[model samples]
Target: MADVMDIVIVASAFGMDAVRAQGHLKCAQASRRAGAAGFEVRRELFAGEAEAAPQRLRALGCAIAELGLWSVFSTPAALYTADGRLDAAALRLAFDEASALGARFVKLQLGGFVRDAAGAEIAEQTQDSNVRLVVENGQLAEGGSLTQFVGLFDALAREEHAHVLGMTFDIGNWAWRDVAPLEAAAQLAPHVEYIHCKTTMGEGARRFSAAPAADDTRFIAVLDRLPRDVPRGIEFPLDATRVEADAAHYVEWLAAV
Candidate 1:
């Protein structure tokens, strides 16, 4: 049998719909008990828990797989202030925080990159960082299309920063932009360092749900297209009433895949 991949439980899943309270320490403890190999610390879920997040996760024996930040790096209007300059200070702080948290990867959105000053700054700063920088195929506005992501990654590769920069392939995010998951996976798999595994239910404005069983052909097909060595994280809604059981089931299901 092949070795099981590392399964990480993203904190945001548990806190969905405000069902579970937001507490990084509590989330870490639950994740460790639920058989998750690691925990992803989301910036939105951190709230005021940022300062001591690393220490808290350490005490709970939960490995920090990635630090997820929500920042738009495309246009100066989104990343800069009134003075029309790149917010290098803010960007540095985000990277610094990820480093302090002991996370191996810092995940962000690929804002805008062709001749964009912010993108240039990101490549320059990431070259010197200890943590790997991963840009994800977020919802439409961030980076939802295969063409968009490929262009960005190809651009970075030419700059020689691809070694330090990687891709976080979100399996279900393709649906949000009408892109086929398999096609996106095929194009981005080589550059992937992390995977966000989630499936959606319903047609319009679908609800994010856990991965199907390993035997499910759709699930297996997508898994086969991704890099097995990369850490795959569960980024879905959790049943607050049965959070532990739900998490454990997800881990087992993904392991089988």
Candidate 2:
């Protein structure tokens, strides 16, 4: 909602070793120094269960707020289970964690969501939740299929439950499922509330996230198609050795582009 594009630095972008050793509190400080509008706190990046406890998260949230930065809580949990049943436990935990962090959004994967009769169940579960719930396309075919997304949105729309959930469009993740990023963007742009900006490198099983080249037209094209007002997360790897140095530059570059 801020006039300036919100540049979010995913904790993992700082690399696992640094995040694990220094903890997400340090990473939040780096994100603020790098001029990021928001910091995405990853569930798996927490040093241990103690660091992820409610009390720790509340303290972390207070610290982050003092830095004048917003937060997005990303959990690897899925909204639905493999059997197309809602994973109430995962969803509840995600919401509770996000609330504790005072995050603006809570991101999850759209797992095994083959269909939904109506969104009443999901809407009820998410009712009164202050944090926005967003589903990201997974890196695997089971949850990343373009067809599944189209169907899911269509169904949500019919039931007027679209407001209950938003999309986290991860450009690089499409490569893992062999889907064209542009094509997916064109169809899903209307529902996207966040963008995971990155270019995938390597091939097949070796594919990994990397920063986009300056003149990468594909990256430009994808951004053009999606809503410009949404937050863009730097999910690509940054220079861990140098810590926050490259993050600021990328933040500036991404905001301009």
Candidate 3:
């Protein structure tokens, strides 16, 4: 285990296709904004043929914490996409790229697959990788039911690749779905390699908000439950146009925590 207070920022929202395609310049310029400390290069870059993507990212002068290698597609619990069906070639290439740069770790999304009786959904881990992989559950369906995910994780823990693979638990997402954050954290603790902290609220309608891990009132308990040693990722959403303000917000929020 590692210190949870060693929080880092991972840039994904700003660099997702739409933002990067049209807002890249502004995005790049905004990195200097106050709250945007520890900017992270997204894993999408690995989707292309630049086998040296990680090296290129590091060369760009950004503070590299970890690079997202792959994200499984899911919206809550429904399997919108088949697991291991997305551009495997691209993911493999990306993994290679990240490993080549000697990145500390890679982030993976745990979604996209409808669990089968034999548990074939997690087949992707068998792919090449010497880098640490952090798998996160983003599309928790029915508001945080852990059944399917637990099955997946159990399989992952026994897989040959388990040595380098661990979990990325998002406290806010679980809370939004109405799960008690501490319980979820306890269930996820053993497998967690890193933490992605965010705060969310709402009932029939849902909203995702970014707050300091400590000030996220509902999730503070979850934070307390986390092992002091796990790596933390403070992934906050920012309004692209209001980059500076949002950046400052994150800085202040973190300072408060």
- TM-score for candidate 3, please give it: 0.64
Best by TM-score: 2
- Candidates ranked by TM-score, best first? 2, 1, 3
Output the worst ten-in-a-row residue range by lDDT, candidate 1: 69-78
Residues 42-125 of candidate 2 have per-residue lDDT tens digits of 998887888778998999988999999999999999888888877889988999999999999999999988777248987887
The worst-scoring run of ten residues by lDDT in candidate 2 lies at 1-10
Pitting candidate 1 against candidate 2, the one with the higher TM-score is 2
Write candidate 1's Cα lDDT for 92-134 as tens digits: 6557666666566777665544332345677688777777777
The lDDT for every candidate, in the order shown, is 0.65, 0.90, 0.51
Candidate 3, residue 167: lDDT? 67
Better of 2 and 3 by TM-score: 2
Question: Residue 103 CA error for candidate 2 (Å)?
Answer: 0.5
> Where is model 3 more than 4 Å wrong at Cα?
1-4, 13-38, 44-58, 61-91, 100-102, 112-130, 140-145, 157-162, 175-178, 203-206, 212-215, 239-256
Error of 2 at 62 (Å): 0.9
